[model samples]
Target: MNDDELVNRLKEIIIEEEIDIIIVGEPVTLAGYASEQTQKSREFAQLLEKYLTVPVKLFDERLTSRRADAATLGATMPTRNRDELAAMFLLQDYLDKQKSNNF
Candidate 1:
């Protein structure tokens, strides 16, 4: 979704669900530099922050889709949304990082 569509969709979700912080996936180049897509994500996050009351953070999304594909390679029931799976893993990684930072 474009930033506008995403913000609109998130507005609906925010009204319906209790949310604290937002984590955005920043897909960097393999060399750890920001790519065009990463810049786009950063800009979207910036725009999102302007509309949101909660904090928004960028998390590295290196190989998340690949990992998601690997994880669900053998699934036969029905194809799950790979994007959602990647988001789940991304959130888990962010949460884990936050937890460790407390130590």
Candidate 2:
């Protein structure tokens, strides 16, 4: 989806689910490397903040997408990587980090 569409969709989900926070998945490259696409995640966070009432945060999404891709490859059925699962991993990773820092 495009930027506007993504923002709209996130707003809808936030409203529908009464979500308190939005954590965006930002996958780095192998061995914890950031790439040019990382800028897009920042832009997305900015758009989300502008459009939504709730807070949006970016979390290190390293290996989450890769794990999902591996799972799809291992599955018996012909499945593909899912963005939602990646998002879930992103949120969980953020939560884990917060707990680690006592934040």
Question: Candidates' lDDT values, in order?
Answer: 0.87, 0.76
Report the C-alpha displacement of residue 75, candidate 1, in angstroms.
6.2
How high is each candidate's TM-score? Answer: 0.84, 0.74
23-49: candidate 1 lDDT, tens digit per residue: 999999878998899999999899989
- What would you estimate as the lDDT of candidate 2? 0.76
Best by TM-score: 1
Q: After superposition, how far is residue 84 of candidate 2 from its true place, in Å?
A: 2.8
Candidate 2 shows a clash count of 0
Badly placed stretches (over 4 Å) of model 2 are: 70-73, 76-81
